[model samples]
Target: MYKNIKVIAFDADDTLWVNETYFRDAEHQFAKLLSQYETENKIDQELFKKEIENLKLYGYGIKGFILSMIECALELSNYNINQKIISKILDIGKEMLEKPIELLPEIDDVLEGLQHRYKLIVATKGDLLDQERKLEKSNLLHYFHHIEVMSDKKPTDYLKLIQHLDINPSEFLMIGNSLKSDILPLLEIGASAIHVPFHTTWAHEKISEKEQEAADYRTVSNIKEVMGLF
Candidate 1:
């Protein structure tokens, strides 16, 4: 069934490397910094709301997240938030940026085995500079023929990528942790996708069961299992 697939696009965050863990840590830190202004739960809720509200304005990734945290802090403290706290928020983002790349187990072996047979590429959403830096640090850049830093992963976006690769929808496949962004959109475009769910999913990426009712795709608990499919 995969014989027609010519391109294999992998999601970078969570799928290839640990990402959400850092964000979760940052969120907790932010909440603790603002504990006097609001309860931790309330602060977390407000920050999530603010991040979603600001998505259209700033897009995704660490820089946007940093801005959102600062804005959330200011509003929570009624514009009375300490400058030092604001500086600490920036530090959180910086620490996340500087964190070492911890790739998923056996990911390199999977890539190594499949790279020779397929056109492997990374299709992920994040700040362009941050993503590029991660890829560089990861030292797995040689495996990919293309690297797409998507603004948003939608059916139309994948369509453009398919066209850019000069391939039909049937020839493209996506593998990622998020069903909402990585799998569902590709399925809508008539491309194949494999779901490799990460243990912790972002709230925005979680979809209702009804949304996945009729979609057909394979799910694997581990990256190593992917090799058996190809």
Candidate 2:
């Protein structure tokens, strides 16, 4: 299927290493910390809402999440949230930022196997510094021809990237977990994509059943399965 593909772009967060799991764990910690003011379910809902609202102001990654937690806590507490709780929230964000990069099963093997045959690239969205740190820690930096830390993943962004790489849309293939961010956009622009489902996905990245059904892309059970597609 990828016989004409010259560039294989990868999404670095959950696709390459553990990311949303840490966010989920942090959310649980946050709910417990603010439980005095609201139920865990309510806290989770409010936090998700706040994160979405703050996406424009803070963008993505741990720092923005931490800020949203603080904002939610203040509103939930009616501006009476304790300083200690705020400090605890900061600590949680710190721990998340400091967590070691844990690569998913077969990530290295897949990269190693394809690096020589294709122009591998890291096309992901997140805080630039954090993404760079994870990529460095992953120790697979040497494999990619380029690293694009996108602010947003849209068809236009992918078009710009394709131009920069000097490749036609038909020569590009993107692999990621999110259908909304990774697969649909690439497919919309005449590029191919492989959806490697992650065990956990943020609500914002979820797509409708009809959208998934209509998407003209291949779906794989795991990242390693991508090897068979090419």
Residue 152's lDDT in candidate 2: 96
What are the lDDT scores of the predictions, listed in order? 0.95, 0.95
TM-score of 1: 0.99
lDDT of 1 by residue, 1-230 (tens): 79999999999999999999999999999999999999999998999999999999999999999999999999989999999999999999999999999999999899999999999999999899999999999989999999999999999999999999999999999999999999999989899999999999889999999887778988999989988997
Q: What pairs collide in candidate 2?
A: none
Q: What is the per-residue lDDT of model 2 for residues 1-230, given as tens digits with 9 covering 90 to 100?
A: 78999999999999999999999999999999998999999999999999999999999888999999999999999999999999999999999999999999999999999999999999999999999998998898999989999999999999999999998999999999999999999999999999999999999999999998888888899999888887
User: Candidate 2: TM-score?
Assistant: 0.99
TM-score of each: 0.99, 0.99
Evaluated at residue 14, the lDDT of candidate 1 is: 97
